[model samples]
Target: MDFARTATWATAIKNLNPDNDLSVPLSDFLRRGQHFAEFCAFSLRESSLCDFLGEACKCAAAACNAPMAKVLQLGKSANRLTVIAQWGMGHDVVGSDAGLAEEGNPPGQALVEGTPVVVPDLSEWPDARVPELLRRFDVTTSINLPLIGRSGPFGILEVDYPQAYQVGPVEISFLAAVASVAAEGIELMSQREALTVQRDLKEVLLREQQHRIRNNFQSIANLLSINAVKTKDDAARRGFQSVERRVFALASMYDHLLGLHEQRDEVDLSRYLGSLCDDLQQFYALKEQGISLHCNRRLGMTVDLNTCTTVGTVVNELVANAIEHAFPDGVGRIEVALTSNREGSVEICVGDNGRGTRVEQCNGTGLQTARQLVTHVGGTLTLQSDPGKGALWTISLPSKGHSAA
Candidate 1:
């Protein structure tokens, strides 16, 4: 039969036998009902563990026809079981504590034996804890089903009726199946909490690493600056200056990457490239040289750290080349524009209003470095230089170049 027809039959049989008999047909019906209850338990998006447990307690009580039900969670003390959720026994008996494994208590017996503990009549029961607990609440029959979780028995599902009733093995099994679903919920919650803790710890470690690496880069830059000042050879001094500029470029990347530490290795190219241009303008002293550096942001995109770094390095080389050679008279305007082309590729354009070079004349170390860096990011570089008018360098970045190999 279809699920709807089977479900209807199961509900009718469940209503007929509130005590839940052990007959084959009844067992199958109860099993189907337990499966449905379990499906609901896992699907519930309750606000808290207490809310989830409360729903679970209600489902158990309704399925067993019991007047009262309680969900007891293993307490922090390990030896104490505290009532976290309840049904029927109103007025909120939550925080009620009972021994975890006391020989006489029903909950304790279930925990100790790793199975269900059923008491047909608490009045004649030898367990003093169970009798006292039931008498105070005017309860007679009780069943405690252990919630066996990954960390052993972590809780108990208790169902109680006002008068005496017989509980067979089949009935106990049905309750145990429901308890397993609750146990899974608790286990899932624990795992989520652990993952959250691990994620938080990883973020902390990443921030620390970023800070340490920045300090080390600064130390190296300081040492290089000192050596460059002491160098007597003109060529050696210029070499030192070039190395310092490259080091500063790397350091700039580190500073920006540190700002995005929470984002892992991803970078917002718009912000990152804008910051790099600002640093370059300051480093090259373009303003003092009567040069205007304009940064135009036309696209907002994010790429992996490797792509950002390579792109940043290329920009640094090309912009620095323009500052040194494009404006030999120390007077010109350089424009850097970032945008996406018609083909959805990121386009980086750096141009200067000064004398430009031919395509075949791209033999300098800076141009060579820029060309190599652009290729590394799976991009193409085009240099256009005309005498007296200007020089324009365009780097077309690939659409899928954001991912690292």
Candidate 2:
């Protein structure tokens, strides 16, 4: 069977009416059509080819009122058909193979001729192609329908009865419809398996690439650290260390990437920010200067890698600036807090209880860089300060990567 034949059968099934002059009852046509619809509706619930085939065999059997049914597929060599699914049959009968050359094998004949074969009375028929196992079970009547796929006939659907049942055109048409569904299911299952394999391979390659990039970033940071230690000038040493920390901040993005199997471009904003703050505290020796740094706890929120990197860089520069310029006596407190609202907007505040200076009074490039970084990612940065009070730098980010007013 091919798509054309399948479409013709579907048309016949759809045009079914009680007034038509048909040998079979109208109820049989309606019932069989219902079975086809039900099978199609629930097919997605099947997780594997074997499971789908099993349900298909059961549906075929129930649709035809047969006691036993089985499905056979042409082997890779195309010389034999192997039993892949069965209903109301012993487990031992599954996985059995039937040669295409067998004189009376109905399934083999169906596959070879690309048509259905009906043995209404196997006992009276000459050289009937019934399997030996069916003979042991006293199967007297059987019908084999070719399961057609996109390429052509690929398998057979066989239904057997214990009594010498009279097979009719209605039964044959219904079984053919069932066979079409089974063929389509088998093809879909094969495609799904192939896609899963491809996705697994891609994931492996991505992980390897991320790992190599992370290592390279670490190497660059290490070289910068070494140079920072060997430098005699305090300003040059500080510059080297600052560049090294920025490199490390970028590298940390890949650390999150390596652990993710899906959503590779998104990072856990809460966790990443917390980790960055801890690293900054240790690197700047905040505890030794009695300048305690604290980051408030936040619920997990995810942001894209680009946005995350930009926010991290801004935070790094602002924190470093606060440590260097805000606390003149090296004795003050700094707090970092992240908050999100129902509108999906995010706000980050880095505040310090130290002698404050207005934004225009600052001379370093750190504050300028931080403001530019925030604006580049469609966010806003503002500062609140008084001469003897503290400085509070607040960053506002809109949802969906939009700019805040």
Candidate 3:
């Protein structure tokens, strides 16, 4: 019942050498290796294939009681196998390549035969092409396990010991099991990296598309401005100017969307509403009439992009309407306020200290457009007015459209 005490006994059983082990079940030892490999694979989800291999080699070398461990991956060229990760080697083997046809290479043989190759003694081996290299490193024993995944054999895991030790069936089986898990982990990691690259590329293309759309809108607005200035009739000129303001408003929407940088289905309304008010004040030429626009955003919130655009367009139309009709005497102030209540609903108030107009008499195209936008955003619009006093237009938007960032 006491797992901790049992684990302590397991830890105290220190002679991991299979040749000396006589008490613990061999399955227990192999189970520990399997658990260790699973832990490594599970914890390394975000790491690169090389990092995974490096850590794997370290663990494998310790378990096999080997002095060195190396993992080679198949390169783009079919016959080339490149050393990607290694542990405990006196010299670096990373980036070194081995040809498939190289004679007496156990790794190449394992890859070809789809099985493990064990050399219990390298010094006495007569068929080894690189026995001198092994002798130079003081390596006397080696085991190469083919890392075969669902796609087939993709690489080899080679471990080297300093002494000429007899290779046992238990060690071979354990190493083969490790190689199997390593192959699957490498395959999953590779797929994840590829998907990340694709997602990044998609974001870049979307940003470019937004930039192009904004530029196109700006060009159209410029053309409208040119035509408005050249027109002889006052009515035609005013109409052109109105169209130009709408175009610029649409362009500002794209500007904010692009500024977000990442793919987002929601928009920050406080920043968006403030920017919309600034743009409308300039577009309506209110400063020339000694009129000032003040914006008060008390709460920060985000809504879907569609709702943001609707809210922005409504604000643009309402503010423009006030500058043109409310302040007929040509000198006054417009205050824009955005606030949220305890119920999580937002209220946007646009008020002007100018001659007031009745809500029923507000039959202008801009007011009608604002009403439609408000309805689409699932909000209500209320107008308060007195003949000599200022007028205030309030839009109450529910919190349903908000996105929880």
Candidate 4:
């Protein structure tokens, strides 16, 4: 593991001279290549920054036949380098700081020059702080390789040899390649950390906005309810109640939207429609009138928020219309069923077992509004009615993005 002897042989092999022996240098070159490959694999497997740096130092030390190696990262001010990772002969120097501007600081000099600084014989150096510092660990030679990033040099890879050693071009080339790979890995890890922070902040802000919107909708509905109770005219009271119900419907949509954290653009159709029906039944006091409202979902499906809202409004209007005019004796059953077909379309059928009316003669504003909404979203509405068998309204919508045709 004598770096100087092996480096001389490696240099001879690089010249491609046929007189010199190449067996030993070629074997050493292959061994160094294998170590470089192992370092790259280790870098990819590690996720934590600290662990990656520590293992990188170990790999560098082993590859260069050096007894010790450490990584020094530049601080925010760009004037100081802090020891972040060490492989061997380290007496707890991980948090130690070295001033970059300090005279004879090898790492600082390497980073400032944007290249490698080789100290062939630290023992013969005169009045230098870095050489004096290395004397404590019995080091006579060292090399500092700058870790260059996108902006510029950001850190240093320092390898310390126990003897006076001259690093040849082949060894320096191998170490420089390792430094490049390590710097790129560090940069990628930093970017991923930043993106994760931004995503978490965005979710917090979105949740706060959802809460405020839900509260505002509830307040509006409550005001409408209070005005309906105070109004003396029967028609005016009914109008207020109808407006209040529509406002509450919008509020319910927001509630569902808030619950869907992962799929914000889509809603659970079965759960949303089922909740809307329950709210309408309670609002109309259907149970006291011997009326039961039932929602039957034949299959689970999800649709975008816009389509779900439109479908909910149409169902609300149709159901309310049945409650008001279908059951004259105040005793009947209403059923809402959701189904999808092989044609990539969804169907909602609202049927009641009360008195029926002719489809051609029906001309209520609610029914008209429902039909218009359905048509606006590239969907269709149909009504089937008889004298005594009850009435059935069917709405068909595209399962995916529905827009005006």
Candidate 5:
């Protein structure tokens, strides 16, 4: 049988046993399903908007049988619809009208003074501005759709082809449908924005909050830095540096949160993890010493910004503990892995062959604080060691989705 057939058979085997056996395959397969569901449900909302726009563009392109087509979202506050996504286009034309809006600019003629204008031929346009733009970008024939939405004129969908192509009636209808979808998406966006706000408030009660969390993290780091400097001992200074790194990790999560709009609930965890790892490696030199990342490229899920940041900080702390305590002589290996189970729990493991968790050596306050923070987020940390083998720090992030209820 093929791979799909094989998978189907394997799934049948699992379904046959609802007893929840201790087999690794049974557990892993179930976990993978949960993660997959989360992935589909929690992906980019803007892409849904972007997809609608792109489909409209594709339809319009096919109707005209045009070689090149593009769609731009006219900024509500700005005068132009910026190029959001595109398909088959001219050489000089790439990024030429990227953000070109109507403000009495050269290409501004295409926007029809912020109004939608359609031209059969660019070189033979009645408007001087249209012909001038054609000359600037070289010979071109294009149709511009003033993407009208529920609010007002949103943007322009420009479909272009060489001199011979013609924009037909079928294309025009499809173009109109594309415009309608874009409008509908923008209208629902305001509604979704309200829903997102309510969702965030439910996650953490704070009014008038628009990413002030980032500032809070920075402030904490500042305080730690000052305290570290006040102590003269090398060990005391090292202690503060440790706290500072954890604080920065939280700051990075806030950065991800601030990047999202009303619709986006998740950020690229691989990108997020790689960046945090880079910062840690630079300071502690994990790259120079043998460190590898085994994180899933598609490993991402949605949680409240506060929760993610908290997780990030904990990861930073545990990773630091492994690096500092794992390889005492500054030589060893470390691996970071992020995987989620089907039951909605996330398994984040950071391991090093240098040494076991030196918790007994860690001071009481730091360890206690770390433990409390993990508990708050519904997670637990496990420190594993083998006599001569390295150390393993396994962190389990509880599925906030089911539990948040």
Candidate 6:
């Protein structure tokens, strides 16, 4: 596996998409690719197949010593080769217009005829549209091999080399192996995308389920609050205040979850956290008289519904706990900041200035539960009281691609 060959192949590919902004030259393409069997193994990984497709194309081109290579997909209308992955052509032209004609399109024909097609000097022929692009890439000869999958003809890998270097039987056999990886990569890419879509759909369904359930529970809580308050006078009603606070907490949590856009597939953590703070301020302003919740900036992170629930629940607990225990005199400020760090982790800090608690004294049941949830997700939660001032609870959580479906 020579790196020079890989570089040539990679150059041919990098030029395909004029919109690609990446500047990593041949750094990622020098692997020389193990055997063709490794292609199957790598393509089977459920991740970014765009990388798989591009890298596999380059690997095949390098292995064959061809000047240019392309992994072309078939269109539905018939006899159409869509250049999904490419490696050899120097020009920006793609698809049938790149040089492969309707008739001399060796790769498309091979994919359709279920056999390999070889043209020693594609540019030498009078009917070849690829000559201009071929000359630009310094390609003299080329071969197209079909990559057949479990279904039918998936796509074809076309390789172009110097004119004197004609493709022999050994090269065809080797390309056949490369095409196998290409086929598997395409299949795996399709499967991965489908699985991702299914997982996202399931999250949406789960969020919808949570919304309905929370709404129903909130309705019940409101009814119970009214009934309990009605069944007693001022002294008994005073006792029911805690119950009402708990009910409001539950109601706020449910309402927030109910009014989200999970169908859009990504959750904005900053907007949600801010809205939660806003809801708490509005809720406690009525309960305790007058207190303001303030935050410096709008913060956000794209996350899953489950992550949203966990983070939102913890935020509610901390902010609400602050409102309840610390600032009972009704005049204070709650400060919050959410940051998505340069290292890809998100940090959320909810602090207040009125009253604070010591670390030992702040270890209540709710705080303990919140800490457990944060730590279980491979993150940390810390609470510090300002000693005659307000308390600050900071939660740092890891936001990966996402959990399972």
TM-score, model 4 to reference: 0.76
Residue 324, candidate 5: Cα error in Å is: 1.2
**What local lDDT score does residue 283 receive in model 2, on the 0 to 100 scale?**
75
- In Å, residue 215's CA in model 5 sits off its true spot by 9.1
- The C-alpha lDDT values of all candidates are 0.75, 0.75, 0.73, 0.76, 0.58, 0.63
lDDT of 2: 0.75
Pairing residues by index, what is the TM-score of model 6?
A: 0.50
List candidate 1 stretches off by more than 4 Å.
1-35, 38-41, 44-48, 75-77, 87-95, 120-140, 161-170, 230-233, 255-267, 281-290, 302-305, 328-331, 355-362, 402-405
Q: How far is candidate 6 from the true structure (C-alpha RMSD, Å)?
A: 12.8
Most TM-score-accurate candidate: 3
- Candidate 5: misplaced stretches above 4 Å? 1-232, 259-263, 267-271, 288-298, 358-363, 400-405
lDDT of 6 by residue, 1-405 (tens): 323223223322332333255342253233334545566576657556555776677777777665567767676555456666666554353543333325555554554555666777665655544535455666667677666555556666778776667555456655655665566556656776889899999878987888787777677667766866697577576446545655666666556655453344566666667777777767666336566677654444666656666777777778777776777677777777877666667778888886677787867777888888787677789877767767778888775823222
Q: How close is candidate 2 to the true structure, as a TM-score?
A: 0.81
C-alpha TM-scores of all predictions:
0.78, 0.81, 0.85, 0.76, 0.42, 0.50
lDDT (tens digit, per residue) of candidate 2 on 245-293 = 7787676645653445326566677777788788878777889988999
Using TM-score, rank the candidates from best to worst: 3, 2, 1, 4, 6, 5
Q: Which ranges of candidate 3 are over 4 A from the true structure? A: 1-38, 41-45, 90-92, 98-103, 125-128, 131-136, 149-152, 258-262, 281-289, 403-405
> Against the hidden true structure, what lDDT does model 3 obtain?
0.73
lDDT of 3 by residue, 1-405 (tens): 123222222221222245555354787687657756664665457777777777778766777777788888766557767778888874367776654524367677766655567788777666546534356567788887777554555677788888987767566655655565566676677667889999999878877887788879989999999999999999999899888878887887778765543247877788887887778777777788889999998655788878888877777777777877877778999999988778888788999898998978998787888888888779988899998798999998897877344
Task: Give per-residue CA lDDT, model 5, range 1-405, as digits (tens).
Answer: 223223222321321222344333555445434533333333335556555555555555654556666676656666654566566653344344444465433234434553334565655654433433345445466666555444445566677766746544434444544444444554566567879899987656443353577678878889988989899999989889877876776666556555343225544444566666666676566667765434432344555555566666777777777766666676766677766778878666777776564546555565567777778878887777765677777777777622321
Cα deviation in Å at residue 197, candidate 1? Answer: 2.8
Task: Score candidate 3 by TM-score against the native.
Answer: 0.85
Worst window of 10 by summed lDDT in candidate 2: 8-17
Model 3 weakest 10-residue run by lDDT: 4-13
5 or 6: which has the higher lDDT?
6
